[model samples]
Target: MGIEAGVAGAVLGRVGASERVVACTAAARAAGVRRGQRRRDAQRLCPELVVAERDLDAEGRAFETVAAAVAELTPRVEVVRPGVCAIPARGAARFHGGEEALRITVQDAVVEAGYDCGVGIADGLFAAELAARNGGGGLIVPEEGSAEFLARFPLSVLAGAVPDWDSLADLLVRLGVGTLGEFAALPADDVAGRFGAPGVLAHRLARGREPRDVAPRAAPPDLTVVRAFDPPAARSDEVVFAAKALADTLHEGLAAEGLTCVRLGVEVEFADGGVSERLWRHEGLLSSQAVAERVRWQLSGWRPAFTGDGTEAEEAVWGGVTALLLVPDQVVPDTGVQRALWGRDGDGARGELPERVARAADRVQAMLGHGSLTRPHLTGGRGPGERVLRVPVGDMPLETRPEGPWPGALPAPAPSVVPPEPRPVAVRAADGSPVTVSARCVPSAPPAVVVMPDGSGHRVISWTGPWPAHERWWDPESSRRLARFQVLTPQGAHLLTLEQGSWLLEASYE
Candidate 1:
């Protein structure tokens, strides 16, 4: 369904090497090299192969680029993977003049982005993916031809479809069935009884009898509003402002419709050709303020470059932020009885509070950064310290914190003063004796400190022995031993140690 530019080969190409040597390398169709295949072996298989180291970041950006381009044709773009995207054609076809024109436009845009891709449009995601793989380049499966087109493919394509592939394939081969057309002709009940649920599903799929509906195009709420930037704006602050305006408009529209929004979808187009979408859901109807807050929160998490203050800078920034769309995913109708009881009072009061909270949270996140705003989540682990972890504001539930604090464990809410790269300090004894740290030293024994040339000093007011920590002992090359010590000093308290007998400051409490 997509072209994987042999990421490894692409990565290898960045380095100086013979293109011929790289091309000769035989890799899996997706650029996945076979097990035990050496670089030389790959070079031998594809003589003109250009080996370039995979740039995952760039590829990620590229995927976004392609997704945005596709979005021009249809708003509903589901990214199948980093290199593949799927769009339901029924609605897009009507919007883009026709199915044929839509297909050509999508293909041309993708190709212009320097990627070779196979585009498949079918009744469903699975069928489309399969069609793309088989059609190669640009393939369209007509609605009526879905069944026939799928029939000719081998059962091998559906081997992993359901049940276990190996067992089903072995059984089918024993019975002389190979292609999907042959498989579909068999009685469904007979195959199901023999192979179980997967066989039944596979049979149905091969016959183009989809059990589920194609991705449905939900009718957007009547209150939905969208804003497109002529030159996409890339600044987070600017985007947030735009989102605020849009949210206000949406809220007003919803009020006029006598409804309240419970869920919203935010889609943004980036200047460097990237598209990002986030879905936000609230337990109850949200006010205009709440919606704006969510938009600001979402934009703050994105890292967009800023341009200096000037007309040119404004133009440049706007060019990057191509579009912003806010759709109400869910809404609740205002019951006549409830609307009569509180009238406008309930409406005005309820909405403003959530909006205020959202704005506060957004501001806090903007100041602290994304991961810094976290909530305690419990996780599966043995110790209390290991049981609980912090997660982003809107992520999966946290595992439970371990129960009951352990004796002599590190203090709660561990000191927040630790530096990223702890500076090493020389510890000295009260008598200014240099307690020579070595592999054989005991951690319980006090060691005096000495100041390094770097001018940082901590005297070992009290000392502990150098405890040996052997890690990765099974790995001959990676094995390492570290000595830990708890040292106290008038300057500060610290956990100092020697690693492989070399003095290092592992941690410090300042």
Candidate 2:
């Protein structure tokens, strides 16, 4: 699903406690991988599976245009989450002549915005959502038909719309309350008593009545900040870097005004004059980092543009990121904000050094292209060298998670310096023969001398290990099997690895 051939992929949670699979492509599911399975189990089910971390921020950014297009149909649209929003059907329907007409209007608007979307109309939010899920040109329930529409669906449909739906559904199905219709038939008092407010609320949805208020929120103030890109951005990294500074400035302005944002908006105007925007929400206050991340994520999801409706071979030559805008869509009192936790400056007290560093890095990137300069982060891996990755600064990683515990991983008193390239070295055993390591990780003999590639030799004074490491054993072509050792000499201790038939010095301890 990622930049690879079809028929492979998986995604898992980023938090260590929840490393279970979060998503999997159809190809992976067909191979027996599924969401909720552990990393090892998913891999065991399909060794070729590609694992990634969830990118909710990016998804939010991409959904902005669709949300804005929906807004054009009616001024009041409430975003429940990325990929879904709720609009008041009554006013829009009256304005457009009817519900069916409104549906077509929405579909057209979304398509024009360059996204395919589904529009669902019914009595309430839950039923409308179900209608959307029915797919195929979007679904429109007849006036007063939400009850009938919900009736046909199984109890499992309650999962997202209703809190604690799973446990209640399981218990209900056992008692023969299998369908939404049957659940709706239950006494409201009985449901409230048995399952509490959530159950009673689910009962309301089952009956086609809105369980919660669905009125459109008031339009947010136009605290939008837009920056024009002179040459437009071709690659994502530079735009993403610039996004960080913009988000920081925008949020700082909001903070000075004593406001905390609930729903935020991001808009990008492309070099070709094409435009896109989406609204994003946060449970608590969103930080500058989060804002920048969402913008970057949104940029990655954008597709390449073409011209002349498939007749012309030319692409939009003037296309790149021409401008970026950040807006605070819904704000709250700054009461919950804890300024002290953020240190001296509200935006992480970034200080001069980081700002200077960012400017220098950006300059270098502008010269060498986006990814030429990378900032290293310690992540998951099996060995010293594998433990970190260099990612373009201010850009988001696709995986977004560190993968490891890497059992038998080299313990750290990490080397003071790791050479950019490993240098080949020769080792001799006590008996004077060239040292070697067996497949079982047994050293040919105890180390006696270390010979540099330059022909300088030093007798070994102390040493440890033959710690073995292996990864992706299923893929023969790419699998790695190596044994590492730490050997000491008068100069200093070095981390060395043995593979194939030669030894290489990988790092040096201070």
The candidate that achieves the highest TM-score relative to the unseen native structure = 2
Clashing pairs in model 2? 64-277, 64-278, 65-277, 233-321
Q: Write the per-residue lDDT of candidate 2 for residues 1-510, one digit (tens) a residue.
A: 232325577767643223666555546756876555678888998988778776676456566667767877786776666667888789889999998899989989998987655688887777887686465567888778888888877776665456545567778888988888999988888999998866887888888887645557566466787777777777666777778888878777777877778778788888766765666666456677777777765664464444457553222223688888888877766775333311123322221224567788889999999999776656677667776667786675555334655766888788888877888998998778998888787888999999977899988999999898787889999998888899999988998888778899988899
- The per-residue C-alpha lDDT of model 1 at residue 264 equals 74
Cα RMSD of predicted structure 1: 16.4
How well is each residue in 1-510 modelled by candidate 1, as lDDT tens digits?
Answer: 122543334233211112112121223333433322334555555444455445434444456667666766677765544456777688888988887788788888887877666677787655776766554465788887777887887665663244345566778889998888888888878877987766777778877777333455556456657888765665656666788788888878877878766557777777667666755555355555556655554444344334355333322333367788888865666453222121123222221323455567678888998676666554433223344466765455543432322233334334335444545666555576545555555442356664643786645577554555565579989986656566666776665556654566555665
Give each model a TM-score: 0.39, 0.44
**Whose lDDT is greatest here?**
2
Predicted structure 1: clash tally: 53
lDDT of 2: 0.73
